[model samples]
Target chain A: MEIFMKHFIRAVLVLVFLILQSTFCQFIKIWDIMPNLVLAYIISLALTSDDIMYAGGFGFAAGLLWDITWGRVFGVRTLLFMYIAILAYRAGEYVYRKNISVCVIFTLVGAVITESIFFAANFILTHNASFWQSFFRTIVPSAAYTAAFQLVIYNLCLKISKMGKERSSSV
Target chain B: MNFFKSKLFIVLAIVTVIIVAFMILSAAFGFGTGPVSNGLNIITTPVQNGIYGIGKGISSFFEGIGKSGQYKGLYDESQKRVTELEAEVREIDTLKNENDRLRALLDFEEREKDKKLVAAQVAASSPDNWYAEIQLNKGTNSGIRKDNVVYTDNGLVGYVTEVGPTWCKVLTVLDINASVGCVVPRSGDTAVAEGDAELAQNSECSMNYISKDATVIVGDSVETSGLGSIYPAGILIGKISSITPELQGLYNKATIKTSVDFKSLREVVVIVG
Candidate 1:
């Protein structure tokens, strides 16, 4: 039951990320560029998760939720996010696990991957002749914008992870 | 055999294959009415709206604080202006009614009177350079269907692509996949206005197939020609921002600054045919 509760809480947090990305994040634009809060959340979730399967599971849930609200190319977000989550899990396995800087670096890479896939997928789907143009123009800048917010999000995730660990240890 | 039997390898391989398959499926077939969108939208609409309202309120509150007493004077001016506008609106309504009565008597064709409009509130938006879309609070229940033309007070926004019970999605004019049959009223030169994934980052759209000899100029008004039958004729789409000669000079392509501001758009009206 305790284990189930732990997983359930994590699952619910993914929904919160969806709500924030669609609603609150809309208003928090820097020069008309809104950060991908859900992507940031996914990276953090995957990094903190102990097991690779757990990362994939949570990312799958979060990405699908984002896709539904996004309503653009369905399952595309899921595919991109789960792939990134698993990637982050592999990255964390090799790197030092519980560092603030490490979190930011992983998030930065994850966001870039997510944005690149998003823009690339869009280019292919739309058959835009300016694929390389859009990739260089839109994807790079947007990835940077999304990565900029990783400072606060990564620290916040660290706090939450620590709290969860302390609670589980106490129990 | 060892690699195939490895649990990590198997899982990673499956995930990769799934990702590749999903992308191919999405590119070939669209993401319309997918497995989870409808059920998810139904559950999230109210909560999303509530969050949106709170988000707007908080931002407005902060803005109000930043401006301080300047808003008070503006508010007074706005109130006075509103009263004057209300008076003018009443006079206009009376005149419109008289004109309609005259047109009925003369058996003249009525314009824009038959298009049924379904109102909706924006629930959420995709925030990025990719796939510009808005999720609306009202959907099939409000008579909004697929390909229904969505517009605002200023001009055409886009059309509905997907509809759930209580929510629908609008692919805005800034989306690269959204193409509208457009015309320059000054030259009658027909063209296709599509959302450019590249230019849309700058909040603009691209027009193609415009004749080389056409009188395409900056600031010329573009509107729906009703050629596509999706949007009604004479609805303003945008203004031509620039016209650049493409290679071979067969036709000139232009950029359109869409009249409807997707950045701040909240409420919209969908015309149901």
Candidate 2:
């Protein structure tokens, strides 16, 4: 019961943080650009959580919430996010969670993957083969912005999860 | 092991169910004009307005400071020209009304165009996403329905695909899914104007199905045909920026430069057709 309560509280905190991130933090505009918080949150969950199901589950929920709030195609984010969660979870096995640089690198890679999936899905549906142009124009700038902010978000998530664990142990 | 059997499964099931429910609710009822969206709009509107205001202030401030001597002359000249244009526009409006009255007297069936053009301010843009969408200040309560055509005086902007009470998302002509049936005004040649992936860059769209023998030169204007029922007839669509002949001798592709600037779209007109 205590463990369940701790995880539950952590998940709620994650949601709250994401909501704030999406609403505020409009500072990272290089040529008018912003980092994607949904992608960053998914990566954070995969790295912090030990259980594959927990990571994937939270990632899926985050993606669905994103689609609802932003109003895009229904399952597009869900599918892309699930794949990212799995990959991030696997990648986490080889990295140290305490290392900040690893978090940044993982986030950069995850950002690229997230954008690649979006472009691939768009191309598949619309048959527009101008992927290179879009990659250079939008994707690279977005990725750079996401990487720049990943350190702060990753550290915050880490501290929160650590506090949750400490409280659970004390209880 | 026990945790895996009981706690893990419960958490997973709960999260999955929540996600599924959220998706269904959003798809069915449009996420509603709940506090979330309303709060976002309320918070975002001022920021967008502030940004625009700052931009205007800085530009004007620099202009005023730099041209203290010549500024008054330029301003007076421009103001005079503006007044003259305003008078001309009023005169044109009067003549147009008189012409419509004359046409009515001739037993011509007057087209009952019942569209209320509501002006909306742009709230936000999706820079990361491939889809080029704009958030408008007006929504369902303002008669801004789904598939309603949105435009500026310059040309066709986009159509409303999603609407809330106080907000609507315009799927612009630059979006991948948005395809407008356009015609070359000079040559009368028809083509489908579809958005490419580089839409965010304010780049050109590809006009397909131009006949091989069609005389479509660069700088030719394209306008919506109203055949799709999405846009009204004769709205300026774009101008032909470039032309490329297809492999077969059946058709050619033209890159059309849109008239409306997506980067700086402020106020837009929603044609309630």
Candidate 3:
């Protein structure tokens, strides 16, 4: 029961943060350029959580939420985020949870994977002859911006997680 | 192990439930219809308007500075062209009336020209992850509906997709989902104009389905075919920039340079029927 409650609270917090990120932060641009904060948050939680299955489930939910809100090809984000969670679990086996650099790397790599998959899906579905054009224009800039923003967001997620742990311990 | 088994099942079940629920809700109400989405759009409109206003101000300031010396000559030339166009319009009006009268005598019902034009400023643009879309200040309360054609003074811009009380979102001509039936004015070859994700460098659209033998040349005008119920006939779309003839027995394609600059769009007119 305690574990379930903890996971539930963490998932709620992540959802609230994502909504705020999408609404308040002008980090995203009209040219399809923006940071992937949700991916960062998912990676952080997935790495730190004792329950990998719950974390992966939450990540899947986050991807679906994004698909609905942003109106992108459904299931693309879900697949990308699930893979990110699995990658985070594997990375956690090697790296220390406290390492900020790992978090940044995870985010950067996740963003690249997410965008590349989206581009590939579009290419396959639309059969656009100019696949490289879409890849360069939409995928590259979006990944760059996501990586840059992840540098900041990863650290913030770390601080927030630390603060939450401290508060729970105090309580 | 039993705890893990039950926990995994529960988590997977919940995740599946959420996904199914979201898909059903989107199918019923369409995506981005939640109260939270509406509130976010409302809150962000002012910020987007400010950003657009600043960009417009900077460009106009530079343009004013650059044209300070040549303003008089440019103004004289523009005035002369306006007079010429007005005279041409008068002659065309006479011919149009004659045609209408002949059709009326043949018992043809005249097409209704009733349209309410609502001018609204762009509130917000599509987020980085999404394709081309613009939020307008007008919505359902303003009589804007889904598929109402939007335009600028220069040419056709897009169509309204979602509407709120005080705002509406436009799916621009440059979105892959949007397809406009267009025709080459010179050659009269009909084609389907689609947004070219490749030509994002120049923010252009492409017209596909032109026959290989079609006599289309660069700089020829393109206009809406009015075949689709979304857009009216005779609205200017763009000019052909380049044409690629059929290869491998496929239809030809042409790149169109749209007149309305999506990067600098401010005010747009929604033609509501």
Per-residue CA lDDT of model 2 for A1-171, tens digit only, reads 656665776677555544444333333345645687767867876787778877887777666555555655455677567668867887889878667778778888888878877778657544746767767777877877787777777777676567557765787
Candidate 2's fnat?
0.11
Which has the better TM-score: candidate 2, or candidate 3?
3
Per-residue lDDT of model 1, residues B44-147, tens digit only: 88898888877778887988587555545655768888667666866998899899767753542244557677778888877454668888899888888999
What candidate 3 gets wrong by more than 4 Å, as runs, is A1-65, A72-90, A120-123, A126-133, A164-171, B1-6, B17-114
lDDT of 1 at B149: 88
- Least accurate stretch of 10 residues (summed lDDT) in model 1 chain B? B104-113
Output the number of the lDDT-best candidate: 1
What is candidate 3's DockQ?
0.14
What is candidate 1's lDDT per residue for A29-122, written digit by digit as tens? 7656677877887788777777888788778777777765674556777877888888888889888877767777787677777877676655
Please write out the lDDT profile of model 3 over residues A56-155, one tens digit for every residue.
8667777756554455444556656766786686677788867776766776677677777666765556655455665676666666666566566666
Better of 1 and 3 by TM-score: 1
Residue pairs with backbone atoms closer than 3 Å in model 1 (clashes): B176-B195
Using TM-score, rank the candidates from best to worst.
1, 3, 2
Please, what are the lDDT tens digits per residue for candidate 3 over residues B56-168? Answer: 67777877687554545645779888667656866898899888767753442222335567879876665445467777877788888888889865688999887777778
Cα-based lDDT at residue B209, candidate 3: 91
User: Chain B of candidate 1 versus the native chain B: what TM-score?
Assistant: 0.78
By summed lDDT, the worst window of 10 consecutive residues in model 3 chain A runs over: A21-30
Off by over 4 Å in 2: A1-34, A45-54, A125-141, A159-171, B1-115
> What TM-score, computed on C-alpha atoms, does each candidate reach?
0.83, 0.70, 0.71
Against the hidden true structure, what lDDT does model 3 obtain? 0.70
